[model samples]
Target chain A: MSYLAFQLKKVFKNKLTPVCLAILLLLMGTVLFMNVRTNPQFSLQAGAKSEIAYRQKEINRQQRLLKHDKQKSKTEVYHDTKAAIKQNQDAVKQDKQVQKAANKGNWRKAYTIMWQQKKQEQTISSNGQDLAGINSRINVEKKLQFFNYLHHEPLPYESQDMPVTGWQFLLQLNQQYLPYVFTLVALFLLTLLLTDSYHQKLDTAQLLPLEKNNLMISNTIAGIVLTLGSFLAINLVLFIVASLIYGTGSLAFPYIVGQYTGGRPLIECISTGSFIIKVIVLQVLTFIFEVVLVQFLARIFRDKLPALLIAILLVPGLNIATMIVEPLRKICAWLPMTYLNAVDIVSGNLGMNYQNVQLNYTSGLLTLCCSILIITIMILLSSYIKYKE
Target chain B: MLTVQNLSLKTRQPILHDFSYQFAPGQFYQIAAENGSGKTSFLRAVTDLIPASSGKVLLDGKPYAKNKRKLFFFESNEWLNVNLTSLDYLKFVKRQWHSNVDLDQELDLLGVREYVKVPIKKYSLGMKQKLIVAMYLVSGAEYYLMDEITNGLDEESRAILYERLNNEVTQRNKCIILTSHYSSEIKVNNLHRLVLHKQKMHEVKQ
Candidate 1:
């Protein structure tokens, strides 16, 4: 085997490393499965039923109004004022129920009911415009209904709830778990890289035919490979577990969003290929950052504990600093840990208008290019310094 | 063959000044000095492990920078990763050297074959030292630069290493430059000794 391959094999053969990686994968899978399972969109017991009931009520009211108006308008003038009043009453009753649900802290039920009622109104009025008298009546009726719901509904359980898109779920997982994995794995590998040499008395590695720079290059390659392997393994395990608990293929984007978001028309977010690309990019970038950090630490300390500590301390502080300092934050955005958190590039919160910035295929390609450049530079410098001695 | 010309090194102060040395093929040279006499520094400088304030090391008439793999340096502490077994360690060296040597034979020679599959961390200091020598032998470099080679070895292990080095020099015609406190054990085979004193290298014959 080539030296690089040999190094990678050595890294993988270690029992603890793979075991730790497997455990991490299991944990991530459990979290993702739980996130999918508890999602309000997938809950057949609550949101779906309320939505259907609300729509049926709205449809019944509209049909009653239509029947009353038709009966009155058999001859010359179509005077259906009584029919319109009954329609308004039905709308008012639906609005009151929504208000009651909201006030009772059943925000999911309220939102679903309100959404269904709005949808029913739109569908009923799709044919043509009503007279001024009828239009005014409907308008006043909707306003009063809305008012009653808002005022009377017990402000339903402050459902800080938004539909969870697949990308969002992955993003959340990355934010909470990726850094921990990256930090731990990087430190573990780096420690073994630096201290193991001393412990094994293999100082001859430094004296090998390879330049100090190349040796460092070898280490960096080893580190990147190990980190990537562990990361993939963890995610794969999570994918399997998610598939099992949520039903087969539920871990896939279309099904995942369908389960959580009730297969809403706006579920387009999870179905796009761009979402998967974003996730992969985020993972690659984070892995690169960890590799670079480990390389730098290994070169500087030449021992495991100090290097590990420095890495641990630096990541959190850098994250906080990136948040507080604007220019620095942009720089940090390029950092793996920071990039991991900022993967919601489409979320529009990073102060850059993603649309205006033309963040599409070209930008993604540029980011990949930039990542390669930074990683190359870091590996070169690290190897140069590390192998120097 | 290895040559060092006008090599000077300093760390916060001058360690060696205008030091020069030459070792021919099949030569076993000893670098002897008192504590802080720049013996290790000279070896490091020659190996390009440390930056020499001024000088150049030549291996086979080419500058050391031109051919790094041909020259191997061994420090007192073996820098193997502790998690690796003896076999794994040999495998790493073998990969670097691209050699097909029987590692089991080498391990047996060093008396470490029994621990071949055991992690290096479990080895005693003497065992670790022997393993270092085994690694240097396996590296197959043209020039071997070993610093404090016999620091932690027991008598038996030391004897085994001495016999191996002697055999390599005589049989394979490899050049070896080593430093050691055990001057008596190394005073054999017309060894050329370089004594470091007053910031200079002085030649001595034994």
Candidate 2:
């Protein structure tokens, strides 16, 4: 049998592997059910409709006042009210057209109209409710556009019952919990598989009819296979389970990427499908890089526990390190650990809350690639020297 | 045949200095040394487990790189995983050497037949030692390097190991290099002894 197959079989036999797998599924299931319960899918469509209804009622009231014989002379409040009524009427007329276009599956046009509506709303007032209404219009229109892009249909919106999208639920679940789950799997299950050669005295492996490089490469491949396999499998399972319950949401939905500015919050969004894909790719790269790292540390320490602890702690440690250490903060974009928190890293919001060090997807990908290259070289060199002696 | 020329090893200090030896088929050598006197380092240096400061080791006049599969080295039971059963470890070693040796027969011979399926962690030190010896014996390699693996075995187990060592050297015509602090425990006839003192070997008359 191939070495990778052998290693995989060995990994399967490990008690930790099964335990960690069970934990992963349980954690995902719990998070899915909990996120479904709370964060009750806020209705963007409802917010917009309410705004329109409010404006129309205000317009009717102002028209009635203009016709009534209450006072001949108009006060400043009355004139302001009259102007507001006209603006509201025009805004409502434009939004109705946008809604009509949206219902006809023209989400992009709807989004454009909502953006204009927001600009119009901003010009009139910065009142929180008005801001929220405009924001809702844009957000809902974008979701509808995404729904169309993903499934090629007008978005079927939720009313009081707020229908939760399965894909959206899974995506939210992943954004918050995947990193921790990935870390646990890496630390508890995968690290031991790699480090056991030194720690548990599996050194008898040296006598295997394979060369040192082949042995190390085979082990690394086995690790990648397991790590990537478990990560994808967990996601796939959650997707199916969630889809069955909540209905698969649009992949084209906007992901709310957040950044902090001087104690204030800023939010923007990108395509959900691309966002999820980017995260998965980066996270897989991170697992491979971490596998190499653990192997390297095993070679140095010649013990599993130390290597395991170091590899597991290194990710979050680096994230915090970038905060306290200015130099590390500056170069965090080039550091592999910065990419471990995939959601934040991909959105350039990794250290926004703490240090404001922006990390883009491209930089995170490039940095992780460089780390993999360097670690691969180190592993090969170590194996060669080991065999050469 | 195995040959070592000008072998020296150092880790911060000279662990072994200019050590050298040769062994033909059908020979077993017991290398003895005081603790920290470089006996383990010498065997490790010979097997390329650890790098030599200066020297070359050859199996049949070819360096270890060429005939690595024919040279078997085990440092005590360091390669044994306690989580694995005796039978599993035997199969693992058998695979490493690409052999068809029946692991159960080896286990029976080593007196671990009753506990072959039990985890090594549950076994006594002597049982663990016997299993290690059984594993190495099944390797069928032309040259065997053992580093102080028989330390905890009982007299019966040690005798079994000695008899197997004799068979490998006499019947199979394989070379065996083993290390021990108590050289008297080795009962193989026609034996050769190398004592390490202060980083050098002194050949003792057999």
Candidate 3:
């Protein structure tokens, strides 16, 4: 066997990589299954209905108050008529003064006097039973008018029916669940690759031809294979679980393609085939970048504890730092984490506008080329150092 | 046959300098030195495991740089992946060398075949050392550069190794060059002993 093949076989024989992949698949499968079972469409419909119902109930309460006030007003109309006329005249005078003061920029003083006058008028109006009934009836009438206005307002959905396409549903499911799966897989593979040698302390490794270089290369290959395989495996398992629960008919390649591309169905969106290819290529590029980054950390730290600590610190720290700096933010967009969020880019949901930037074939190729070049340089430098030792 | 000419090496400080030596086919050479001596550095330089500031090494009258595959170097501490069982490791090494040597019989002769299916992590220091020697023997290279090959071997394993080395040199006509502190145990009529001192090579006779 060639050296590369031997390295690959050795990696497959490792228990860490496989176990990491299994856990990722299991987690994704469980989350996806639960999400499908919960039926988000049902929840959305329920929420809309509850909001409408609450509004209607408020309108009904106001109508009932208006009916009660109408009956009371008939009994007290004659007794309160003179007092009500006098209060209206006083309120109109106060409104004029306040308006003038507001226009002249002495609004604070004017508001104080207007409030005092309104309180005095309210006390005078409440003195007689007929006056009190008239005031209550007027207030209720105003509230009833407002409620009537609301009743004429449009409902959340005019037809009371919202279609939930299988494709849109699946996309939502992936968005909610894929990130945790990817993170867990990355962590598991990194821990295994970084710690395997330290845990075993195998004496034969040092005796191999070009011992240090070989060991480092083997570990790196193992990490990359493990991560990539786990990623593919978890996604495949998710697809399977989704098919089983949602019915395989809803998961035909065309249906998935259509659903992913805004529900145009596969035949209608044949023009999007190139876009789909670009997405796949971008994903592969990001996977490679992630593997290289993990391998570099493993090589530098030489132990699981420090590797994991540095990984944890670096990921969030870089993200936060990237947000505060313009250049770093642009660079961060090309990072592995950013690429893992590639689905957003495909779905036209990026937070920033990339209108002038051509992030098509050229950008994807450039990212892949740069990642490979950096990884190659790191491997060569490491090998040279090992040979020197 | 191997030749070292005008060799100088340093590990943050000078260890060996202006060192020159030569060995013939079927010859057994012992490198002898006290603590802090350059015995290990000289061996490393010859094997090209460490870079020499100024030196040229020739194997069988040809520059070793041109033909590195025919040279084998062994250190006391073996560096094999412990994830693999001993038998699996032997198969891997055998494949790497691309030789038709039987690793099972070699391990048996070394008294380690019982642990062949066990991981190297489970092997004791002496067992691991024996395995290293077995791997070196199976490598079937023209020149064997060994460092402290007998350090952790039992009396029986040590005797077995000495006999194997003797047979490899006399019958197979291979050159065996090694470093050892146990000068009393090794006896050969065609033995050549060299001591590295004061940045130069000095001949030592027993």
Q: Which number leads on lDDT?
A: 2
Q: What is the fnat score of candidate 1?
A: 0.57
What are the per-residue Cα lDDT tens digits for candidate 1 across B70-99?
Answer: 767766654555666777767777777766
How well is each residue in A215-331 modelled by candidate 3, as lDDT tens digits? 666666766676667666666566566666554322222211111123211112212234445556666766666666666666566666776677655553454455466666555
- By TM-score, the better pick of 2 and 3 is 2
**Candidate 3 docking DockQ:** 0.13
TM-score of each: 0.71, 0.77, 0.67
TM-score of chain A of 3: 0.53
Report, for every candidate in turn, its global Cα lDDT versus the true structure. 0.61, 0.71, 0.58
Best by DockQ: 1
Off by over 4 Å in 2: A39-73, A78-152, A157-165, A199-208, A250-275, A309-314, A320-331, A343-365, A385-389, B12-14, B111-114
**Model 2 clashing residue pairs (backbone):** none
Q: Judged by TM-score, which candidate is best?
A: 2
How well does candidate 3 match the true structure in TM-score terms? Answer: 0.67
**Model 2, span B155-181: residue lDDT tens:** 777787788789888888888888987
Q: Spell out the clash pairs found in candidate 3.
A: A203-B78, A203-B80, A204-B79, A204-B80, A205-B79, A205-B80, A205-B81, A206-B79, A206-B80, A207-B79
